[model samples]
Target chain A: MSGQLLVFVICGAFAVLGALGLLFFHKAVHAALSLALVMINLAAIYAALDAALLAMAQVIVYTGAILMLFLFVIMLVGIDRRESHRELIPGQGVVAILAGIGTLGLLVFAILGSFPAQAVGLEAANGGNVESLAALIFGSYVFAFEFISALMIIAPIGAMVLAQQARLTAKKTQRERAAARIEAYAQKGVHPGTLPNSGVTALQDSIAVPGLLPAGRISTSSVSQAMVDRDAVVNVHAVSLLTAQRFAELSGEVPPAIIKPEPVDLVDTKDERELLK
Target chain B: MNPEMVALLAAVLFVLGAVGVLIRRNALVIFMCVELMLNSANLLLVSFAYAHGSLDGQVAAFFVMVVAAAEVVVGLSIIVSVYRSRRTTSVDAPDLLKL
Candidate 1:
């Protein structure tokens, strides 16, 4: 029954009660304000515990960055307030009630288990200062510290991408993707020079189509079949014209001509022998 | 546990605040819960200060107040801005929440 123990009991009660009130409250602003109360009280609690540096950080970092971020977001989103606009998830109330009860149980168990044990004063030992904690955090938790930096980078970028301003670029990207698909197909040598209204060419392709022809299109199908039958006449004409032009260029003999593409050697990074093994 | 009471209590308050944030749909409420958790730990530190009979705790607590005041100023302004963007004040309706 020490004076400090008594102080802890009183402050702890206030904190627990404040937290519960914050949870049960309906209005968000009120909750935030109450949470502020919790912050101040916590600082006081830390001061009582002889850890001055930690107390300040609690107020500065926790009260500063985290809460401000919350408020900023709250103001930005502008949710509908009318009861009609409330989109309550199914079983939410049930879950909330269960959570509240479970929280109460845990607090009670902790208090009971902790009862009668005299909470001693650790004034003799150093309550790891900023320097010591920073040493450990930077040394042992270097990865985690770096990870937080990465998170900071990623979170804002992610937020910006979803924002309304970015919607313009998003639409542009979609258009680019569609155009890319069309370009990719065209690059694969699919009738790049053909006119848009090349009905005869399309009809010719239909004859080679492997699937069923549509019903009531017997006339078109017959026309395509006739074109296929006239294939020898078309081929002979085209081949004769090409050969005549070549013969003229060669002055009748058409001396042997050859065109070759140079071979290219590319550097490979993989270990070929290891891969073979 | 006694020497670590502030740490333990700070941890508790912080956790409770987190729970408040998770359970409550109201943005303001969650924010307040977070502030509460911060202060709860602050109180533990103050108690430690008194226990150690040192003025460092007092100095830290003073700085914490300054930070808290600054936080309120900045936080409230941000909230005002957010309110303008979004008409409602519920956490569930945050624009970034949709999966």
Candidate 2:
């Protein structure tokens, strides 16, 4: 075996070990670091083959961008410092172990199986590397590419909405909870420490959108407007206001602005959550 | 080693990468796994490009890396926001749809 073979063997070993480490490791940061090692090794493998394009890509995307994001998230969430993360999920630890074993088994089976035989047969069909793949990805897989774009657009919106569902509920409940907490404390006539919790931040964001929810909780702050795209702003804010108002109505406290006794054509399929007077 | 052996090793890395991303529990780890997987794919493409005496695979790899970089920027922010909201790095915890 030559130096090149030795390099390949070493890098390949790191990639496999890193992959195993990624699976078995409990600490997220450690796993992330292991993944980075695997990526670097893969790049080295690319370099050994004289594939400069792939080598650079391996560095920039895997090392520079993606792994960095994982670290950033870990940092932002304070995962390393929190005690809550230490608490094992109900059945997760056992299940994760089982799943890991199952996954390893499946991968081993799949790889050692007949796929390579079929892959070799298909090699003749490939027109070339970058050009052909690009044509196919951008052409035949255009829908998939667009789907990815759509995912990029919709994921944040979905995540924000989902994460804030409880916060949204708490806004109304907060009104009640605040009244109760305040009244309980107020009877003692000592003002309860009025410092709001994280719930307030959600409400503040929701409110910043103009007319965007059950009670128009969204404010038309320029900063918020600047954050979202112009095309989506109107639609997002519109839906938000409708939903917010509907939620407020469920709380039986209709804001007077929309409570006017006019049979306005507002109660349509569009406002699915609106309650009739 | 010959190019074929290097190609084989690169393929091995690619396969490991896929396994890492698909199986990991922690979001950070999962993201790392994704990186590993992408890099592995890059290696496979690069090795094939060289063995076939073509530059196209390398070029395609460059574009893939560019897009991957963009993905990381957005993906990280999303994960960060999720961590802030849920206070957990476990991907299982983000299943807000069930709730």
Each candidate's interface RMSD (Å, one decimal) is 7.5, 6.5
lDDT of each: 0.51, 0.58
Off by over 4 Å in 2: A81-277, B2-23
What would the per-residue lDDT of candidate 2 be over residues A1-277, giving only the tens digit for each residue?
A: 8666788888888878887787777767777788788888878877666554456667876777677767767766654432223423476555655665665466455544332321222134345434555775576667766766776677556645544444422345667877887897868875466532211222344422334234433323322422342222333334435765776778888655543222233334433222211
Give the per-residue Cα lDDT of candidate 1 at A135.
Answer: 58
Worst 10 residues of 2 chain A by lDDT: A195-204
lDDT of 1 by residue, A1-277 (tens): 8675676678767766667667665655455556556655665566456555666766676666666666555445532232222536777656756675577466545644442244444444455556544554566666755665565566555444444232222445767866776786788844333223212221233432222123211122223333443331122222334555666687866544421111111112232111111
Give me the candidate number with maximum TM-score. Answer: 2
TM values, all candidates = 0.45, 0.51
Model 1 spans with C-alpha error above 4 angstroms = A1-3, A77-95, A110-128, A167-277, B1-23, B27-99
Instruction: Identify the CAPRI category of the predicted complex in candidate 2.
Output: incorrect
